[model samples]
Target: MTTSTPSTPSTMRAIASYRGLPVDDPDSLQDIEVPVPQLRPRDVLVRVRAVSVNPVDAKVRSGLAPTDEPRILGFDAAGVVEAVGPEVTTLAAGDEVWYAGDITRPGTNAEFHAVDERIVARKPVSLNWAEAAAMPLTTITAWETLFDRFALTADSTGTLLALGAAGGVGSILIQLAMELTGVRVLASAGRPESQAWVRQLGADGVVDHHDLVASAGEVASDGVDFLFSPHSKGNIEAFARIVRPFGHITAIDEPEGLDLLPLKSKSIAWHWELMFTRTTYQTADMAEQGKLLETVAGLVDDKRIRTTLTKTLPDFSAAGLREAHRLVESGRTTGKVVVTR
Candidate 1:
């Protein structure tokens, strides 16, 4: 085996997995030591203080196969910068920051991690580390789905329906639509508690997915102008019935299959929003993520939006990570779940 250089620092603790296993399996996550990452020219090294769990984490972990190297899994993080690469100009040691790290590389489940500077932004001053950590991944997903995929603007006036509004992405999307745009929002939630939660987030009305058509029709007689489906893929026919002709539908879930034939009659526009696409493809506008995070930080500081963190584990240990993943996989979580060092 290759040895570390004499001057290189030793390993850092991380919660990682060696093979795909069910969330309840003890072997699904383990505490281990990993060598500190070396930085690329556009990279910034962060001393991670907090991280949040999401559906993608569980999905990716469930599909991961055994390998010699363990896979660290976490996307959203808040931390202090420990070092910067030569080409990294916007951040430096001691700078407080938050980011949704690129999915194409090792993630933020370590004591320290390196991330591209173009995808990071200063953390919101109004929130603590865990709260800040909870926002990035979900914020990026909601923001991109609303503005990039739907092409919505502040002046836009129409009804926007959010399916599964009690989850992280939906909670934030409801607030974004209410605070940043003139659109009327109709949020769908199956449970009474979830319905109340979305209403607290400023949803103009709440609908039940089981009674979707009737409940949605009560909100918008002319049909909703946009549908943000974070869940409820089985309700596509209801979506077709309630959405206006040429209305836009955006989603982030990985349903087994979606048939567009139902939507063809209305000429509905369908769009998929995967927040990692920019960093995964190294897109030309990857820096736009940093800019958007800065905007979100400003919104949070101004009280225009709030962090959606509803649960936080005690520490950044393997047990903590596993518990967080279990809560995410449970499907009953109302908001975000975080782990802090």
Candidate 2:
């Protein structure tokens, strides 16, 4: 573990796990006092006001094995800057910010968390802490999926099919595709409620994922130019059939295994979008994420895109974190669920 000369109070409240445990177990998450994190040269210390739970949170928590130290699990957070490292010039103490913090570090499930300034952005002024917290992880995933991984341009014209269109990433992706590109988006929903939700988010059309072939054919006779499959485990064959020759396919979920050989005949391209890649690898362009998030904040302020925070838990506690994890793991949530301080 890394240590630094103390410059702040020693301990703060946090929810964490010292070993892997099932979500249903009471001890799966516990309240504890941890030393306030010390900062790196490019880091910012945030006083977390709110945090939003995602599938990644549950996945990481459950996969944790026994270790000497407890692991804090959270990614999406909105907070005020409590401190900044010497090299962090973009922000200072007292600035309100939001970020999808690095997965390699202690997370936002604490009263105070330190994150690299390169991936943090100013919070959207029009949104409250909970609302702002809901956007970072999902927004970064959706943005990189459409524009970065797929290399889509504003003038590109085609049909896009988005599977699981009511989930956090899908909900935001549907809106961004409509607002940022010329593509006609055809979102797939399994339930009527999800269908209505995607339409409300401005999908050009909605289709039942069960009858993907027929539903997608109605929208694009020649097949969709792009397929965005957030849940791709059982839908790869369907995607290959409905996607046009030479089209692109992108996914974010952890499918068991993919057989890409089937896509060869049509010369289709497939890409994976993991938003954590940039920060995890410390890429040369990591700072681009902060700039892009700033752009997203501006879009929110202009009302061109809206926050997808559909639910908010009362406060950051063991009970609240457990419930949030259960809701996300249920796989029925329509948008984002947040826990406020």
- Full-model lDDT for every candidate: 0.90, 0.90
For candidate 1, write residues 1-341 as lDDT tens digits.
22222443567899899899998899999999989988888898888999999999999888898888989999999998887887887887888999999999999999999899999999999899999999899899999998999888899999999998999999899998898888999899998889889989989999888788998888788899999887746878888999999999998886888777899998999899999999999999999999999999999999999999999997799889999999999999998999999
| Each prediction's TM-score versus the true structure | 0.96, 0.96
For residue 2, give model 2's deviation from the true position in Å: 16
Q: Which digits, one per residue and each the tens of the lDDT, describe model 2 over residues 151-196?
A: 7878989998888889999989998998899899989998888889
Clashes of each: 0, 0
Model 1 stretches with alpha carbons more than 4 Å out:
1-9
Quote the lDDT for 241 in model 1.
Answer: 97
Location of the lowest summed lDDT over 10 successive residues in candidate 2: 1-10
Show where candidate 2 strays beyond 4 Å: 1-8
Clashes of 1: 0
